[model samples]
Target: MFERFSDDERAIEGLPVRLVIALVVGIASLSVMMNTIGGLTALGVTELDVKPQPEVVAEGSNEITVTVITPEGEPVANATVVAKDGTATLSQIRPAKTGPDGKATLSLSPSLGPNQAEGTITLDVKPPAGGGYTDDRENTKLLVVSGGAQSS
Candidate 1:
């Protein structure tokens, strides 16, 4: 029994104090860790970052140069160019940005049916991540085709 732990005629038959203390400390440490992580997570620090959808610019154009210039009229490179018809959406047309001369070539697709609305061509420009802003060209340009060639 525990009474025999002294210099008696018996031996202690139980775990040592050090082992018990170690187990308790380990459990407490784990609990604190879990609580800290849970609390930090419960705060508004979720790992969900959503980006605002880029607005679509419908200045329809065929063989047009959409120069996504900066506030200082400097061209943007490696930017995303999307042309959409009011009826259907064209696949993301991401061509290389303008060269040092600030010029990019754009060739409009004539796949839409003559009657399928061909809707409208909206030009949405996602400028480079640095030193520029998104350009909402607005209803400025509209490419109207006539005689199988770009009219305006």
Candidate 2:
């Protein structure tokens, strides 16, 4: 003989536990995926190129032109360009903003150690705000030779 169960004994209460767990897991996964995509979109979308008029300079004052462009080589205007000392000693470099031509001229004074033969000055750029541009690529370097000698 089999015993019959009552309706109250078989009825489930509130939300199904499996459904609640699935909803929480789905929401968490969606949040993580969205964050990952957003972070990826914020990187390496732009490039910065530098052309030191002479490509090489003496141990004193120098001028360098920085160009902000996209991966397609299209110019990006209003970007800010910054300079930093690499293996060379340099005077404080003032940041410059690019014009409509995507060019910013920076004045820098690069110097070398008394015994160092040559060094390099590094350049970086920050694309205009809200343009979804990133300055994560290697820009360019300026060569500084000793004794006021320029590289051929």
Candidate 3:
């Protein structure tokens, strides 16, 4: 059997409805994405300023005091401070938490490799939760000298 089709006018009855649904879905998704991005920025972010007392130390057992503060120079209390080996070798590092004065004392025994003149000990801070504090920036570093005397 052979049939001949007549082109009167092709009708797209459901095309507009499908297009409208897609448009609505797209707008809703965009709105949700924008809100999520806006929420992150709405949460205030604070930068940590870590400082190690006696910036330079001899290659031996020493007690270093670390202070955590905000950019506004306000001390950040109850924050955790961790000392890690950067270019130096650390014997053991016990993470310390800051007190009301935003100061934590850490006992670190750093050693330098043979023939190594100097090295660095890196410090990191973890601000208290819900404080909107960020520790992504560079922190203070401690200098460990092989033979030089420790500085106050």
lDDT tens digits, residue span 13-113, model 1 = 45466679999999999999999888753343211111111122232434656555554555556665555554444455434355454455566553454
Worst 10 residues of 3 by lDDT: 1-10
Error of 1 at 89 (Å): 6.5
In model 1, which range of ten residues has the least summed lDDT?
A: 45-54
Estimate the TM-score of every prediction.
Answer: 0.41, 0.75, 0.76
lDDT of 1 at 9: 40
Indicate which candidate wins on lDDT. Answer: 3
Error of 2 at 7 (Å): 7.2
lDDT of each: 0.47, 0.78, 0.89
On residues 71-132, what C-alpha lDDT tens digit does candidate 2 reach at each position? 68777899888888899987786688989988888888888987999898887787789777
List runs of model 2 lying over 4 Å from the truth.
Answer: 1-15, 43-45
Residue 47 displacement (Å), model 3: 1.4
Ranking by lDDT: 3, 2, 1
TM-score of 3: 0.76
Off by more than 4 A, model 3: 1-43
